[model samples]
Target: MSKVRWKPGNLIYPLPAALVSCRSKTHGDNLITIAWTGTICTNPPMCYISIRPDRYSYDIINESKEFVINLTTTQMARGTDWCGVKSGRDYDKFKECGFTKGEAEVVDVPLVNESPLAIECKVVEIKELGSHHMFIANVVSATVDDKYLDDTGAFNLNQSDLICYSHREYRKLGQKIGHFGYAVKKLKKKPRRKKIN
Candidate 1:
């Protein structure tokens, strides 16, 4: 098959649309919907979120050095898009979006109570990358909504109807075909019973 080529740019799609909440003494709490966010490490538990320096939430996060990453769901699609479009300078996102501010355990910032998962992060470093500044942080704490927990106490995140950002569009997570290692795992064969003549 032939393919057409385009100029180099960020082609990665279907990224997690997280609402990052930040607060400081000078500035009140604010939520910024971030699509440029992901886990950087697993051992020490680290993540990063890239935001435009001009964003109101950027200063609050820089001053506080902490933020909570709240996972978005299909129910929060409107609020997520709204928060990203509107500036915190004019609107109180939490109140406007009808979201409750739930206190985080390790960070001073509050999390979105409606979210199924909230990850509290403390900034360790900041990289000014042209258009956006990447905040590299260590995960201080992570809280999950009990409603998303299965009977075995395992997190059923897929059932949460999580939403993602793809090419400026918000989409819900689709069907799950397999687990982490299913592709490489061997299938067990059933033992055949001897026929009695």
Candidate 2:
């Protein structure tokens, strides 16, 4: 196969379409659907979300310095798209999207009740980039929906219909590709049965 070169751009596809919730003294509570979000570090538990400077939630986040990243599912596709398009400056996204504001354990910001998981973050620093400003944050708290927690206390995120964003469309997370370290890890060998035969 041959490869074609295109113009320079950030072409990383399949990003989590997280619902970022925040609150400010003046703005109250709001939601902003963000695809430009991901985990940055794991040791101290860090993550980030990038937003345009002109976005309505940008100032609110600046004032609050905290936000909740609510993981979205295929069931939440409609609300996710709507929140991304509408502005907090004009509409109350939570109310419009019919999303319940769940209380976060650590952060002042509220989380999406319908989300299977919520990552509460506190702003550590803000890097002003060209079109978008990145909010580098330390993960303060993470709450998973009780429904996703099994009897054994294992979180079955695979059972939840999680989704991702690619290009301009939201897509469901299909079949399990592989587990972490599956490449180098040893595979179990099947037991031999000969005496019984």
Please report the candidate that would top lDDT against the real structure.
1
- lDDT by residue (100-164, candidate 2, tens digit) is 99999999999899999999999999999999999999999999988988899999987889999
Clashes of each: 0, 0
Report the Cα RMSD per candidate.
0.8, 1.5
User: In terms of TM-score, how similar is model 2 to the real structure?
Assistant: 0.95
Which lDDT tens digits does candidate 1 get at residues 1-197?
A: 99999999998998999999999988898999999999999989999999999999999999999999999999999999999999999999999999999988999999899999999999999999999999999999999999988889999888999999999899999999899999999999899999999
Q: In order, what lDDT does every prediction score?
A: 0.95, 0.94
TM-score winner:
1
Query: Which regions of candidate 2 fall more than 4 Å away from where they truly are?
Result: 194-197
User: Any idea how many clashes model 2 has?
Assistant: 0
